[model samples]
Target chain A: MTQNRTLSLSGERFTAVYHIVCKPAEAEARARDICVEQTIEFPEALVTDASIRDQIVGQVLSLQAVGEARFEARIGYPVEAAGRELTQLINVLFGNISIKPGVRLVGFELPESLARQYRGPRFGQAGLRALVDVHDRPLLCTAIKPMGLSPVALADLAYRLALGGIHLIKDDHGLSDQTFCRYEERVRRCAEAVERANRETGQRCLYLPNVTAPAGEIASRARLAKDAGAGGLLFCPGLAGFDAMRALADDDALALPILSHPAFQGTFCVHPDAGLSHGVLFGQLNRLAGADATIFPSWGGRFSFTQAECRDLVAGATRPMGELRTIFPVPGGGMRLDRVAELSDFYGRDCILLIGGDLHAHGPDLIESCRRFVAQAG
Target chain B: MTQNRTLSLSGERFTAVYHIVCKPAEAEARARDICVEQTIEFPEALVTDASIRDQIVGQVLSLQAVGEARFEARIGYPVEAAGRELTQLINVLFGNISIKPGVRLVGFELPESLARQYRGPRFGQAGLRALVDVHDRPLLCTAIKPMGLSPVALADLAYRLALGGIHLIKDDHGLSDQTFCRYEERVRRCAEAVERANRETGQRCLYLPNVTAPAGEIASRARLAKDAGAGGLLFCPGLAGFDAMRALADDDALALPILSHPAFQGTFCVHPDAGLSHGVLFGQLNRLAGADATIFPSWGGRFSFTQAECRDLVAGATRPMGELRTIFPVPGGGMRLDRVAELSDFYGRDCILLIGGDLHAHGPDLIESCRRFVAQAG
Candidate 1:
């Protein structure tokens, strides 16, 4: 089997998702029975009312179908679990839950015949080199506004930051579809502002926006962001699904890189001897899922990840991929400007450096403000 | 705020969903950049990619994108942040990867309100009492088979168990959409055999089939199971998303009690500190989600939860719900007939005693098999 992105659709298991529509009143029973038949992957099953009414059998999680003809359903089963060695890739396409209604398996893909698939990180090490016209050394990144900033206010910040030589500028997680600024409008204006600054300063900076939603509607937004002239879009794959990140990686029309966030994902890393290690979770998994750069809370930050964990994350990001590209690890969160050289020493050059609220408290000439970070860190 | 299950929509915060389709090739890139944008929350405001990619925005975390097209997409923003938040809701639907040509947002439902919509275990306490004919005491349950049991073999076991007075009988999670035990055939025979046993013993034992799949096709399957004379269904809300499970509870037409299973959900409990607590995750959440009975890995067994966690889980299950029914917690995973007394003592008489493989390892007489558990447990 080729370990490249261009995987053979045959043999590898496939999954097809479908969303069914039904009266809200009947959603739970419907979802349960469908999933049992699909994923339990067994036979002669019997469930009793004692089980249902007492939640002995069906454990309902959301009440979305509270007053509508909607219910979310999912069935997952291994393709070749037993005698069902494999057949019409379509039929077995995640046959686990295919029959359940109101559960449309939107993210469909072919799994490797073996345990793994793509090597991931398409433009990893060398590719990124070609993109930013950089052969070596690290990268830099900063945020625009955390809250309550107009689009122009954000763009003005983008211009000064871009001119001052920051590599990328993005909105804070809290900057989502808020009344203060809209996604399409803000992204468009910021990209333009960055482009204008690039023309004068001759530095290339990318503009990215946050995009995270339910199960549908991610594609058009990417297109919209692209049309608006933004460099890329950002998302929380854990909240959405890692497959969503995989999807973004495969779309060229959107033609931008993806950055993974750790919001709501801390639970997975907070435990030791349990859950994926930080390197494996934020670094390798994100890379495998096609992250260009994976972010983690740095040492001496408000968050609790240790310096060792941060270092391991960087190593995992830059490590080898079989016939795939390498990923860059972005270590940020509660960083101090005075420690710019320390961060550089710890992460080296091929990293995206992030600075948040501290940027503002450093004296307001925005340009002069950022130039200081560059002088000390660079 | 009225709690109407029919046609009422109410929520404190406006929640919308987005769905995006990938162009197949640029999937990874689109995935990576999206992460950067959302997490960094619009970095173009102050950083230059070259400088950051090469030098200053100094922080942590990095990103990379893929060149695959057929990827997934979705974005979530506050209702106040989006225009006609409901209109753009489609963008974040189907998980953001179902909006393009090849994919589709199969199913979704955003609760009109977020103030605890689901009231789990519809008839959790009282409902199950009415069905079983045995009020106020614990419910005894025993699984039917291991992986290699034939249909006739399983049928015989079901018949004996039902006649022996086991209140609930369910298929192992390992059984599913497989050739070994086809769903329809197994369900038909089991229901019939249990019926035959009921006639002879005058004991009405309800059969619970594991019904798990994507939400879309669940209605029909549920209808099929209900019509098939099966008593109820089983489901896994973790893998399929908790919302899918709640959808099942609202299903009164086939009003089978829902039994929540813990398969891929160990993570939620395994991380003692970070993830949800055993009591909250299993008890409160499941109760709120509508699980009449939830199956969890019992302590002093194969799984890792401690004795306190297990006890807390039971407490969570049966705790008082102001207007809703209390759920039964089914502690399983490697329990045996020998522990029936201990389990009963620990959980009291209101729980569903679940023992799987141990039943198989017991002397093969199905009648004696279930008799041992019920007699000893009670």
Candidate 2:
């Protein structure tokens, strides 16, 4: 966060850095267009209120050419434009401008007055580590997958994984409330199974069910998961809006840990000259939205993210932002058992080591394989 | 939609057409990877359950070359996998696959059973036309913007626009609950102003307030707008999830027509080979999610959508899909008064002609400008 604090704000304005792809001659005008487009959204001459034009409209503080035919513009908007809500803040940041081509929101700087307003990560990396009682080493985690599995099969797998000393067992992101394995039934079965295994082995294991649902059902579903004795909840902010997760995380009654999944948000980081940077979306935005742990496609996996991008994402998650807590970076897209040592070295002890399919790939005895994973990662 | 029916379903399976950019030799393997990746999300060999593999796993039905090193693959999954929910359907459609590069969801075919389950557009093009009592011509629309304006100023603008016979007057997407003009005061004042003008002019002008808020507050705000005498609602499915709009549109109590705005969804259509097509996103998906009228960047607007893409989008909206009604395509975004005749000829009378700043730019008398716009468009 320190290194990426490229936005130098003067007064009560929050700055956003946009990567504008255009010719050198068009850079200043394009930057100005964004300044107006993001704020007033009216023609400059028509805005009769002088104070509104001066205070409310966005101002381009600085512009520099980053590459050939591409300039990075740092535009500042009044913090009042974002209001006090995360939704409005997001809209003010990248609402209408998202429709235009060649303008990518690379990074943003929210002043401490505004940044601290958001209650980010009720239970961050330390709180999660405390829950599992694994303080010094990377926490071992896995997802129960192959979506068509029934509640009984999934719960049985959950029991074995818990018994084998896995810290966290999450439902696969694809495992929504389908008829084959309904949400309530699956959460109850898996939570109870994990509890039973915890009692037997004296090792705490959490069963996190995916609670991504429609806007009307999402909050109620989170409450349902909590009532069903689930340890934590798996939320996809991309599917449900980011503020949905923030609301869940901020709720005192359902004060459970949230692990944000990047389900439909990949497009934000996939392109270089358009959309958002990987760090801004997966890291800063996730943490700002109250994710205790964030899962992204790690390097050397099925996804196309490079090691440098992964490192930047980790930094964005853990870096200091006023008083916000640092969350765990769970990088688990196509991660294997053999890569644990190397990943642990790369991410260090602060991350949650997530190995999904490879846990089942190691021989017929799933419990033994989990134990071996625990031993190897430990 | 008729011409782009590339998907051929069998039995109870709904098909999806994916544009996979890969080497010509690797197209088959890549198509197979999408099948396994989208559904099971595990190694194909490791999925031992024959029934699960047969019933739930995504299957590639056909693969063909579309362009230079680009292949179009139609993949099918059990209808039950969608789980009678829009959120689950979206998750199943693009969830984990969005993170993967070169895999774009171009089109999809939902069986009549699956399509009918979704409440597409309660008040579609016909219903909206009935509301305004203007069935013969394009409904002229304008947005009251310059985000920092007070509620009184905005209300005055709304009044003039309504009095001048603009069919729809909506709050600019930028005009959220900012401190200058909170949502409550703004919606109430604007709605009352529009109603007052409607009373004077003996017309059915509708005031549409932008109710795009945090997930929990969206429905409540929509209800508040209805209670305040607002004739319709403007929602951004991109900011709030698509299902949010569906939830609002489907709610019987709030039976206001919804206009879907493309706020943060530009990234999905910006890339040709990475995300969804303009038609699939703005048209078919919006209508499926219950938007009565979909607002997108017109071809000649400040945005970069071409005439071809705009035409495709219109087709996706209006084309017959089982028993679903057609939605109005409101082509806007920097649209001017001078282009009204050309746009009308382009989009036909079924579309809503939205001109924002140009009306204000015409003269000091906004009502006169609105009257001129109505006369010209009419």
Each candidate: what lDDT? 0.57, 0.87
Candidate 2 versus the native: TM-score? 0.96
The segments of candidate 2 whose C-alpha lies over 4 angstroms from its true place after superposition are: A1-11, B1-11
Model 1 Cα displacement at B249 (Å)?
A: 6.1
DockQ of candidate model 1: 0.05
Total backbone collisions for each predicted model? 224, 0
Error of 1 at B29 (Å): 40
lDDT of 1 at A179: 43
Best-fitting candidate, scored by lDDT: 2
Docking class of 1: incorrect
Per-model chain B TM-scores are: 0.70, 0.95
Clashing pairs in 2: none
Candidate closest to the true structure, highest DockQ: 2
In Å, residue A146's CA in model 1 sits off its true spot by 2.7
Worst 10 residues of 1 chain B by lDDT: B1-10
Q: What are the models' TM-scores? A: 0.60, 0.96
Complex DockQ per candidate: 0.05, 0.45
- Model 2: DockQ against the native? 0.45
